[model samples]
Target: MAHIVILGAGIGGMPMAYEMRALARAEDKITVISNNPKFHFVPSNPWVAVDWRKRDDIEIEIAPVLAKKKIDFIGVGAKRLHPEKNQVELDDGRTVDYDYLVIATGPKLAFDEIEGLGPKGHTQSICHVDHAVEAEKGWQDFVKNPGHVVVGAVQGASCYGPAYEYAMIMDTDLRKRKIRDKVPMTFVTAEPYIGHLGLGGVGDSKGLLESVMRDRHIKWICNAKTTKVEAGKMYVTEHNEDGTPKKEHVLDFKFSMMLPAFKGIDAVFGIEGLTNPRGFILIDPQQRNPKFKNIYAVGVCVAIPPVEATPVPTGAPKTGYMIESMVTATAHNIRDELDGKQPSTKATWNAVCLADFGDTGACFVALPQIPPRNVNWFSQGKWVHLAKIAFEKYFMRKMKAGTSEPLFEKMVMNALGIMKLKDK
Candidate 1:
């Protein structure tokens, strides 16, 4: 029986394991490796940071859940990947062999690329539950002594939705606490314009997001390159469209949470023919590595070029719907290989996202994540906030049940009238 090993147990990995299990031959073996023993819903991290959701509410013990599905669980994590030998070295000095490997370990937050960034330094983060927990402590202290707030993603960062979500959520929280008047918030981003979202501004996203920020009294600086962060101060260099430095600004803040750039994890970093210069796994349209045919990738760890270049560099985002497509495609391709057929399935790479602002939220849909799509839609309402919360609960339930159903395709896309959009 062929053995398939999946690295990571996050948003992409967990679903991959379940889907693989459902599709693989009963005699085939499936194993999931993760550094963290528990799986936390990453999208809820912003809520966690603001005390809207607690850690326990989102985190699920991984081992038991995988056990119910009859999949082996390894929490020791991966130290290195020896693709040539088809083996993975574990952190605890063990090794696991696999007939096929799926790298879904997600991105390694590149906070050190900038001076005094990240939780270890002057700023806070919500990339992980642990980071969110720590940020919550800072949030508590900040509410008591409100001051200037800095929130946005840095250069080369791929994920932009969370940065926007947190900014709006924090605004909502402050308003609820009746302390918003005391906080001056600024959004600093590498995108050429507001709501570029690393996909070249979806469906009037630029105008809509800018209007929302204005209404919320949040100021913004685009094409911003964050150079350094010191205690209570952040250094930024705004850039012109020609990539020339335009202005230098020194902003002071009591609380800051800047999304850092992401790169491939250490286990697969610098692996020849497997990753790009930034360490993201290089995958063909089928989600299979071109050089290493037996290896595939999904999620944020997969390499995707920027939709368009701006003054400051930014990477394209692999949103939840896009990643789900990748996972489904990867599973089908692997199954096809096992059946002695050439891989044929391809992920649509569509982009659908819900950005919650606590009380109200926005939803956007791109037929394909890249620009020049058939359908580009964006809308906002209180219903989106409710939908996002429902999505969270439904996703968490799906994980616990170990179901391999495609949540995005079956629910989100359908609800958004994707069928009608596609017919256009």
Candidate 2:
């Protein structure tokens, strides 16, 4: 019986374990390794940061949930990955052997790349639930004495949805508190345009997002490179389309949340033929490492080139729908190998995003995440906000139930009338 070990217990890893369990032979062992004992819904982190949702509301004890599926759970995080030896060294000085390893460990937040960034430094973050909880403290303090607010993503950052969500949510929250007029907000992004979103602006996304920001009276600066952040002050260099600096600005803020760039976890970084220069796992079409065939990867840890180059570097986002497709394909491919069949399944890599602006939200769909896609759609409405809330609840329920069903594939695609976009 083959032992398949999955690393990290976040969105990508949890679903991967469940899907693998459903596909693998009964005797095949499936183990999930995570540093954190509990699985927190990352999408809800923005809400948590604003006190709209609490930590306990989005967190699920991982051990208990995996136990119900008869999967082994290891809370000790990986200290190092020895792909050649087919073993993972744990922080507790133990090692686990695996016939096949799936590296779903999400990206390491590269806050240190910039001076005085991250929660410990100057700006707040909602990347993790803990960060969000800490950011909530800052949010509370800010509401009491509101002033200039800064929010956006930094250079080389991949995930842009949450940055947009948080900015709008904060706006909505401040309005509710009747303190919005006192808080002048500015959105600073690495993207070439307001709605680039690292996918070259999905179907009028540029216009739509810019319009929304205007309606909310939120100002934005694109092609912005955040050089340094100090307490209540940010240093920014705006770039021209030719990648030359156009202007410099020093802005002061009472509160701020900036998304940092992501890199592969230390465990897998700098491994030859395994990861890119930025430490993102290098995988072929099948989501399996070209050199380490037994190793597979999904989610933000995987390397995907930028949809288009801008003055300031930006990375493509691996949205939930794309990650779900990757997980499904990886599971099927591994099953194929066990049965002495060649791997054939490939992830569609579609992008479907819901950016909640608290009371109202926007949704974007790209059939193929890459440029010149088959379908590109974007829309905004209060219904999108309600849909996002329903999605959060449904996802949390799915995780608790230990089901292998693909949430986006089964529900989102059908609801969007784009089930045909998925590969059968």
Tens-digit lDDT string for candidate 2 (1-424): 9999999999899999999999999999999999999999999999999999999999999999999999999999999999999999999999999999999999999999999999989999999999999999999998998899999999999989999999999999989998889999999999999999999999899999999999999999999999999999999999999999999999999999999999999999999999999899999999999999999999989989988878999999998989999999999999999999989999999999888999999888898998788888887888789888998899999999999999977645654753234323
At residue 285, what lDDT does model 2 achieve?
A: 96
State the lDDT of candidate 1 residue by residue for 271-309, as single tens digits. Answer: 999999999999998999999999999999998889987
- Backbone clash count, each prediction separately: 0, 0
Give me the displacement of residue 64 in model 2, in angstroms. Answer: 0.8
Residue 345 local lDDT, model 1? 95
Give the alpha-carbon lDDT of every model. 0.93, 0.93
Error of 1 at 305 (Å): 0.7
